[model samples]
Target chain A: MHCLWCDADMIPELSWKTIFWLSRPTYLCPPCAEQLTILKGKRCGKCSRESDEEVCPDCRWWAADAAWDDPLVRNYAVFSYNDAMKEMIAKWKYRGDYCLGKVFEGAYQTAFKQAFSFLSREAVAVPIPLSDERMHERGFNQAKMLADFLPLKTWDILTRNHSEKQSKKTRRQRVTAANPFQLTRTVKHPVILADDIYTTGSTLRHAAFVLKEHGCPAVYALTLIRG
Target chain B: MDDYELSRRYAGKLLLRHEILIDEPRFEHLLNAHYFTSETAIQTKWSHHECRRCGNQKPSLFGQIPCHHCGETHVYCRKCIEMGRVMACSLLYEWTSPDQPWPSHPNACTWEGELTTAQQKASDLIVRKIQGREKEILTWAVCGAGKTEILYPGISEALKLGMRVCIATPRADVVRELLPRLREAFSGVYIQGLYGGSLEKDGTAQLMIATTHQLLRFKQAFDVMIIDEVDAFPYTHDTSLPFAAARAKKETSTTIYLTATPRQEQQMRMARKKLPHVFIPRRFHGHPMPVPVFHMCYSLKKDLQKSQPPKAFFKWFHHRKTPGRQLLIFVPTINLAGNLTQKLAAILSNSTTMAVHASDHDREEKVQQFREKRFQILVTTTILERGVTFPSVDVAILDAGHTVFDEAALVQIAGRAGRSPSDPTGEVVFFHDGKTEAMREAVRSITRMNKRGGFH
Candidate 1:
């Protein structure tokens, strides 16, 4: 088999676990996989960035705002926003190489199970939605694709208004922009928000606020990468 | 976005339909003024979505990407995606400006150096063809025959006649090396180098040096096209590149194809008198090609797998490791390259060695250091097979019988040695468990070339 990224010959990782259980094979070569920085060590409790403080400066600003009753909840990320991850996302999202989504399948499943262990099994997982125009353009929502790997009950209850991409906005602009999310239905159980990338935590916080207003008791977020 | 800026940005240039979006302000004015006209980028119709650009018909390489701007499922060619995505919705754009006048000088070429007798003859014939009615000529010169120098007179004559010229090659490294030499040869000429991420893409120049992939953007834009390394990889294997090269030239433009090893089809065409051709069998330095010696060692791979180099191979390695003699060992795969580098490193503990392949992040730096005499040996795959020269370097092919070692590749690998005129000879050894046809063919070709002496 060839590596999905470099097209080099991929030697099978012949381990005892693979031979005994026949686990799903890896798509990337060892070096490419190693380039992915898994979130570990000391990190901010809210944004999952490598930080010495309990909350990063961005999260602290969110806490100091008088518009909300409480600060944003914690988030879990699988990787940091490195150059390699940026290229991989460009290939998958903009280039429309949909099959590359498999590169994160196994890792996302493992990270999901580890991060949400404290929550009950009945806690619903909802992917932040793409606007109708974006959904049609991209064919599939990336957040929904990541949610497919989770074993929990998944829902598409949140909808988004058409707005410019959050990536194109500055931190101050992102915080001051009007919230673009709306709930389609009220939920009583706890909900886990899923997204492909978490930046500034404004989008996730906005989605969490909409969910909480819709009667959801608690909201948490899981992202593939933190920028 | 005005007419002056638009003309300055895109005059005499070829661009894809999607590329216009890169500079929206300029494209908007061009669209408003109707200065932009487009043609179908891919030649074939959309029944099967076969890419005429890269000749890739693989379903995996053809993607149906959805675009909101058009609200349609766009089919794009992914094989040449690194260059840019060419989709069914995309069109190739050419500026509809009047032809720019070519620059002329009393003496277009500033090179004062003299060519060898054979090179001089080839240069005269190439110039006559360029100035006459011939559309194509093949210069089948052997390796290290100073092929690039032979084109100077012809290119100068073409420029003197007020024609636009473009010199294209398959590899970017060759273009990078050739650009400086060409600029130095013609001091006053406006020469622009075109490659990926090149900043001179918008310039209007009499001469353009670019990679073959860049030809896809042009539509009969050049009056003269010179294709170097015509038989090299991705050019010979992909049919679309040659098509693009042909399409980039005018109806009556002159094309000169230069190669050391023309394939059998090219040879047949030459034999049939269809392709006007010239041959230079000897090197510019008048030295013979180095013939390879084959040694049989049974089950060498098995021995190497057991962390032991075959006794005979080790003996030969030690014998050749005299001071100041650099070694290059070619292996079939990256795994073997790494394994051999480790074993050799353990054996020659006092010497410095490194393994490099296509995926190595430091490939360029390592090769540069090797040329600087910092590394004593380099273990590599066919990534360094051609377009790299190291004078007085001896080469060895481990597992030479492997299927990947074809005749053309083996010949190119052997050509790596004996390149420099100062040290025009070196040892070439093929260590294999069994003799293959490719081995015999490489030896036969070298010997045949050596027998034909340089033109007096």
Candidate 2:
């Protein structure tokens, strides 16, 4: 009945391919998809980020804390990509087993509660967006499942565009998908982007760029664990 | 053109394409039905037709067929023809078959051994310490101390309590080695082996043996975790993964680290504060620790520049790397390994020399060749230096002055010698043009291990 990510105007479309493959009828308007796909500013490897044109040639890579080109506010992870996480993701992403998402229903809530508890109490949890093609192949997006499981009043704010897989590309080729996201909606609170894992910080940075562009005060990320 | 030639050309050069356009009302009807059928419903009379003779198509349901040049039935349902079934459509349903699924757990150990006297003693101490103290525990003993066997009772206890146990290694080959051992140890227990390139299976195992990277897949599924190579590659340099391991385990779950060479931080933690740790000084071989030496190669460049083998280093290598002894030569780069391999192959006799690296296209074959003793001399990069050992083998670090020769790398490289009992005596040489800080650090670590393991 409702779109999971940037809760834009919801419309249900039924196709055998969509139902059997995706099992969900939600769709992302072009604008909502853009929010989850841009690169924003300079970022610290451990946390904060800033805008840069390239892997800052002079970036001091730190074992504990280094700077990345784009900065996302905070990373909020629903679960660590472990047995539990794998069990849940397999169900949601491939096996069409919706019950796995139920196990970690409270995880995202706990993260949201902690992330938004003191500062920017109005901070909202935004599930990392999946590309439409991926959502189709996977049958369901686990992030969306977590959002729905919590009924966390989430907004489908970011959209990953149709692009080559980051794995399929070299790091530089992967960077080409950087910061292309554009946002069209208005935000009422700070956004804390939620995902499964945090690796290079590229995904969160891109999503934060879009959120910041939409007048959101700040974007923070929290993952179950930082990969 | 001949028909056969034309067909061959099409098959080789062209991709087949198919396109279909469904009537709007019938498409919606099928969508509403939510199942595939031989024929979708239509709101009006059938008016569309296709000419097989001329490849002509029409959108209207009712039309005169052009290719047939006849007033015949023009509209036919493509779904119906494809299905060849009456009044039935294709239906989609989910299936839970492993095409294949990632295995939920690692195969348990088959190295069946009831706790030996020492194992039982270690087990008792470990259990008491685990329950009593939250500080570090180091099980320092000889090679046959049965470090893995000691963990068994504890692991079985955890499994009975419905807690998760995971073991991670730095190498996949090690996982392969341990899989059978684990299978026998945890008989009837559903254990998962998690590693990269592992075939997919459901994650329902109580015990999981995984590579360190696969730990990335977990989110607090384990009550406890045992890191087999705690001081091994990807673990020492990878700070994020230790945190990842912590996240994968339950908050109250204890983290047990196993290694022959615990890094300085681990030692500091054991001495300065309480941290959970364990060690096996000697291997299964009941022998003294292998002595490590540093032989500086003064004329290494002169030999290479002259397209020659470093003569002094070669002489030292030749004496040890006889027919009976095995040798592991670690070079700084693949290109260097190649150069030395060619030279060694030409000069060496009564011994075989083979080279391997991460990029070696025939890595598996080379590893097999080494195991089968097809090659007595194995020139490799740092990749194989850890997690693999050849008994009675001498270790030579050429270009040991390079920065890639880190303290950990050198120590690990030196560790490969004298691992098995049959050939407990091995040699380690560092043929460096100049000594770097890492070279000294590595030598210090080895001597420290030797002294701490005095007369083991």
TM-scores (chain A) of the candidates: 0.94, 0.59
lDDT of 2 by residue, B1-456 (tens): 333332222211101011112355754554466422222221223444432211123232112111122323223322112111111121211111111112233323344557655457666766655454243366654433346778876676555555567887767777766766777787778667766566743334667788765654344456667777677766776554565566566556666676666678777878875665444544444455555676766888776665466767767865665437777888877677888888888888667788888756688688877877777889888888666645457778877887777777777777777777577767778887888888787777666656655553
RMSD of 2: 24.9
Q: How well does candidate 2 reproduce the true complex, by DockQ?
A: 0.01
Candidate 1 second chain TM: 0.90
Badly placed stretches (over 4 Å) of model 2 are A1-227, B1-111, B114-121, B129-146, B276-280, B301-308
Worst lDDT window (10 residues) for model 1 chain A?
A93-102
Listed in order, each prediction's TM-score against the native is 0.80, 0.50
lDDT digits (tens) for residues B314-366 of candidate 1: 77877774446788889888777888899889988888889998667788789
What are the lDDT figures for the candidates, one per model? 0.80, 0.57
What local lDDT score does residue B215 receive in model 2, on the 0 to 100 scale? 57
lDDT of 1 at B370: 88
* lDDT for residue B198 in candidate 2, whole number 0-100: 68
